[model samples]
Target: MNTTRTLIAAAIATVGTAAHAVDLKAGEWDIAIGGIVNAYYTHTSCSGSQAVGGAALATKGLGCGGTDGRTVIGNGLLPNALTTTAKTRQEGLDISATLMIGAAVASGDAISNNNNNVDVRQGFVTFGNADMGTVKLGRDYGLFGSSAILGDMTLLGAGAPVAATQRNRVTLGHIGSGYTYLGTYGQIAYSLPTSGGFSATVALMSPVDAGTAIGRNEPQLQALATARFGGGKAWLGVKRQKFEGTGGAASFTMNAAEVGASFSAGALGFAANVQSGKGLGVLTDGDSGNRKQTNVLLQATWQATAKTKFGLNWGESRLKDGAATDLRSNTNVTAGLYYGLTRSVTLVAELSRTTSKPVTGEQARMNGFALGGIVFF
Candidate 1:
């Protein structure tokens, strides 16, 4: 069995699952490497008239430009990634550093030389031991909504594909519809050593603009508390930040909270989460105004056989402005079948439906099907 040494593996562990990372020892330092690579072919069909003009709620609209269906071959919600880590104990303190690089498999068009999309998602260092809380410095995923996304079944496959023209893009996977993306952030954070099956984390993260206001004056604060028990776990997280008025713009604050839980019994798994916030946009953190937003996610999975699993999920995000009648929502549902072809490879097939509903306009709806495979190592 492999130890949980890689950051990616640690992420998966949050949801009561783990991945095997190949490890090596070089003298005094221990090294490990692991990641995932996946690709999918997706077809999206649209129905109902699209809303006129640009509506913030229009969001992805299934990336459909018209009623005609579109086909795309590209990466899913998760891009191909390669994570490397090195750790050592010095002077009674354990230290480690990790760097994760990810790229889209679709590359680009058939041009002679098309550029690919590559990014460094995680670059951080940690120093501490179980006796003392660990401190993380640099860039990594935020705590808020981290569990929600990690526990999502679509994390292993495609949920919603947008724009067939941009093959290099990754699928949505309920990002804008279900939950705000817990984007990686530059920050200083501390994780308390686990005690009594409970642990917590707090971070002061790099700031960003909140709608029209600027947040350069202060840092974003994020915290999370998690509890683990037999065959189950639960978590709660919060995020808060203040933005200053710039160029006569009004000042505003962004605050968000989320709660989630996951558990398994007799090869059957269930998960659910809820998020509500102000000034938290449907997709990203910042949007104009201190609008109220809420998100809900529900999922269930069953291990039908040693080599096969089935999953179904529903999620929605709603944004409401000050106006009583101005409300917009995005919703998506996905049904997936996963088969383990090998110890380190899995095949996936998924069908998904997405809808965008505005207070006054035609609803934009899309249906999609995806087939893909993912390998972990």
Candidate 2:
């Protein structure tokens, strides 16, 4: 009986040791993979030129037979011809994915990755903790590139005019259309620990060169601070970029700054943002000339029920004189509503209208509407 009891105790100890060894050396990593699939039907109403039979066709020329006068071909294929009409139609899907990995780091050292082939969604490695803040490096969001009130909800496609513009501002570090800006360069950010519901972050990013002439441009710097008081939150931010070359033979610099606030009460939220800056051509209009601009956006959101929310937004941008007027000034208004279909799925419908007046005596207006569903995993 004594030998049997001793054998059992020894076996238990051996098993415990093996479990500890596995826990220490195996599966010590954490991985998270997520994706969003947004399928939408879009309709637009705008008067624009269309193509017919591989040739530019006037708006009135649409629906006409090709210049070759050939209409029917085998399998509905254009026999040496094609045709297009300026008809509003519906379109398909927009999908994106993201993967994140994190691991324990030793003091003074951090985890890093090549980030190759990864979509421009997000990629970064942070070391340290709240006490000492943290050092983050890799492709990531730029400081001051987004307003706090808007940044928090960018994933849902709502934000300030500047924030929305930043998504397509190529020379300003935005990756491009249909992709999130990863900033493909180095970034250093420090996030102060939350204190009394207030926090701040300051970050700097290396300049992204668009060409040889712009290769030597100075680095981009941004500073953002946010404070929450009562039921309202206010934020202030600044961003600067120095173009490398002389503009119109005049050597100068470009800068931009923004301030915004948001307040909430019960089921309603109100937010407003304003930005004024110089040399924003890096993102708007894309001219190397010096220019000053201001943009403002106001939004309101209401939660009518636990599963539904509605939003309205209005935005406008104006370019100061001495700037090219081809792009002119524009105003946009968007209204949207979303309903939660499930824990991981949502249905959204939105309508947007834009009006522009160009300095070249051209006036245009566009209206677009989209209905979509987003599935997350």
Candidate 3:
């Protein structure tokens, strides 16, 4: 084509791409960038003198100090993060990719060399259709408890108080305390088309590698189905896996299940979930064993005003017959408020109490209060 024809074709291509995405445009691709910056000042009082050995504990010489009270700067439940996305419309389908990373905000490390600095939170590609289904591959959140945490009121603030010295720039919203951790993992997942407010998902994931004479021979299988009714949504998920090695030891098997729901009536919202498993790793690391793990979570929120909200949440996680030769459990309760200072800025405050206990060890209790702000762009 001639120079004039080429220029006109380029202009037309730009206009055609504008209907798909926003932020910035480059060649045939649309670029979008966004992020959240959050920081909190926290005061925690610990009640325990026992020092078993874990990096996360409340002893006179460990984490935050027991009975002496410690104050520090940390992150809320939502860490300071940056996300960049690119997408294109092809054959009536949305083909997209996303990259999410966390920043070290409160580490006081000017070089961002801290342990929690700049870790990849998500890197995934997806293809979806409004009438058809969706397929995703790469690293992303798991399906079992995604809704429970997404609907949690504490997602905007600190919920469970972890070890201060070992804090990772962000608080846990009942992750290790109330539910089996739903970590990000590599998987090929497919979501059935949504129909009448219902949908289902099936995934094949890399299996856990329990150390034995040999490695397991199969990938883990997971499935989840959700239904929406009235003002709430409910979900059920199940997972099954087996780790076998030849030699003298027996094969290890894991069976896990979870159920959860979220509902809203007027300005009041509630959410709850429960999970149990035999031989499922507490953090879903794919380590096969004969241990038992269980967890429960509950939350309630109220929108007091257009820009002001109040919320309370609780959760518990337990491990019985664990490979460690003892039982362990954690329970946490949190109450907080969120006030929107502007359309893209928010003020958050929270108070939380958590207890950690082991079968034959001293129990530890921690009380913490946090004040923070989050800016989104």
Task: Pick the lDDT winner.
Answer: 1
Listed in order, each prediction's TM-score against the native is 0.90, 0.65, 0.82
Q: Give every collision pair in model 3.
A: 178-316, 208-286
- C-alpha local distance difference test of each model: 0.77, 0.43, 0.67
Candidate 1: where are CA atoms >4 Å away? 1-7, 10-22, 52-62, 65-67, 112-116, 164-166, 245-249, 322-327
lDDT of 1 by residue, 1-377 (tens): 01113334643442334457889999999999889888898888777656522223223433553435777777887877899889999999999988999877664456532254576888989888888989899888888878888788888788766644236657777787788888788989998888888989899999977546878878999999989899999999999998787778887789999999999999899999999988776666766357788999999999998788899999998877544224477788999998888777778999998877766766777788889888777
Better of 1 and 3 by TM-score: 1
Model 3, 129-243: lDDT tens digits are 8677888888766776665566666666667645443255566767666666566667788888878888898887766565662335777787888898998889998887787
Q: Which stretches of candidate 3 lie over 4 Å from their true place?
A: 1-22, 49-69, 108-112, 164-166, 208-216, 243-251, 283-289, 322-325, 360-362
Once superposed on the true structure, which residue ranges of model 2 sit more than 4 Å away at CA? Answer: 1-26, 48-118, 148-185, 210-217, 246-251, 282-288, 322-325
RMSD of each: 3.2, 18.3, 8.7
| Candidate 1 steric clashes | 0
lDDT of 1 at 127: 86
